[model samples]
Target: MFLAATTAGDRVRANPGGQAFCPSCMADLIPKCGEIKVWHWAHRTDDCDPWSEPESQWHIDWKTRFGLQNCEVVMGPHRADVVARDGLVIELQHSHISPEEIAERQRFYRRMIWVVDAGEFREHVDLRLASIRTDPYRQQPTTYRSFRWRWPRPTHARFTSPLFWDFGDGTMLNVRKIHPETPCGGWGYLWTKPQFVRRFAVHVDELGDALEDGATA
Candidate 1:
């Protein structure tokens, strides 16, 4: 509960592969909330291997590679352990931070990336679990599938869900959006919280064409 207790709204990251590995229970997972966020890591069964810890070595590697320094290991706000680097709060699974911490850290860089370790999944866990989408599986999942980001003053960063279709390429021609106001047709445009303007539709044919035609510098 440290995740919920400590870092309430401290920016949540999604369990990539659309699944999580519960430390308390060992099995494949279905996200608890209406959607998935690492802080909401849980298992349908009672016994699951949690993403809890000082944090996994994979997460450590990600931090080091990304240049995190003087990190502290404390539970979200009221539990276990969390790592905070350069004013950025790093929560593994449910490592939550306090509202005060969030407000204070807002002035600095508010960036964090949730991680999934390839070595920790079940034997039955498919490497393509994320791509499987609606397929059936028996093992609990462990992989960083999706990412959620937040910024204090609103950043120019954004992402869109991939598009699908029956065109010659079998890929959806989506659309390119620099911001939420950019006008996306049938496909949806996604924007991170706070700014709520930076949005995009992944793999848009327009973007692809722009890149191919060298319209994008």
Candidate 2:
């Protein structure tokens, strides 16, 4: 994780010898500000959130976009990747996940979505223009495209939450739905980075309100 809680309950980024605790379990955290990997905090023992994978630069970049307070949010016994002001949990997935684990997270968060790092599979995935129609999400004329993976990941078939695929580009593929056909394919809406963030995250001006609500709650 990039941030840990101070004794005063304030969220802070990792610093050398920074004494902090895990927001989810109150466990002592070791500040890992190495020159090699991404600077982050690690629990002295084990991670409180079993769903958490090792943070990569990809994860850090996305979390940075959402801001520290909004990322790594504690909800009950688990720490969410990103929780919007409207109570939407956004899970950033980069590593391989089991179908059963995906279902478990959906059940835990209840109201959640996924922003998957699909760069690794981008080369194997094919996109075709399906139609040129008015996109209800963007409220504009958009080019709808259908995506098909040469060899689809089994986990993709079990996804129940809304999913957006990020391919290291400045745009996102908002998957409308997965196709049931033999060669797995789906039609989706395309969104720019700014558009998706604006539509999902709380406005910068309202971040104070979000923080206050979290503090008070």
Candidate 3:
């Protein structure tokens, strides 16, 4: 967790010699400031939530973007990675996650957005995004198949929210209005069918105006 509660009930980041406790479990948290990894608090015992994944530099960097104040929000029985001031939960997913897990998180945090690392799929995403940017009018809509099992897909239409797929190189694809159609049978079933999905894409750099408009809504 990025933010831990001090004895005085104040939220603090991990620092040398600082003592903290998990906001959810209330267990003693040890501040790990090793040079190899990002500084963060760890449970002194084996009481930490199993669902919490090990934090990577990418995850830490993204969390820092929102600042510590908006990081590690305790909601019900789970702690969200980051919660915006407007009550939007921003979940940054770096590693592979199960579809079931994705559905659960969306169900738990109804008002949320997912920032997923495209990782290996980054190249495909970038190419498609470039095509959209180069000739949006001509391209209209482009579809790309997801061969990687870890890649997230639109499970349901009702869970419609902007999903920012980060390429980890400062490029991001904002996808919305996702509709997952019937799967293509035969050998094509081996991979996720691009034709079965319909989504609108926009570059993150071009999202400033849209985001500003959304803030008002």
Highest lDDT model number: 2
Model 3 has a clash total of 0
Q: 1-217 in candidate 3: lDDT tens per residue?
A: 6678988879998899988889988888999889988888888776465557667777776665555666777887788887764677888787667777877888888988777776666543313222213223124343332322223244423334556666555445454434345341111011111111112112333334323322121
Q: What is the C-alpha RMSD of each candidate to the true structure, in Å?
A: 18.8, 5.8, 9.1
* Native-referenced Cα lDDT, model 2: 0.81
Model 1 lDDT, residue 207, Cα: 32
Better of 1 and 3 by lDDT: 3
Task: Order the candidate numbers by lDDT, best to worst.
Answer: 2, 3, 1
- 10-43 in candidate 2: lDDT tens per residue? 9998899889989888888999998988889998
- On the 0 to 100 scale, the lDDT of residue 206 in model 2 is 49
- The regions of model 3 sitting more than 4 angstroms off are 129-161, 177-217
Give TM-scores for every candidate, taking all chains together and pairing residue i with residue i. 0.21, 0.89, 0.65
Question: Global lDDT for candidate 1?
Answer: 0.27
Model 3 scores a TM of: 0.65
Kindly report which residue pairs in candidate 2 clash with one another: none
User: What local lDDT does model 1 show for residue 12?
Assistant: 23
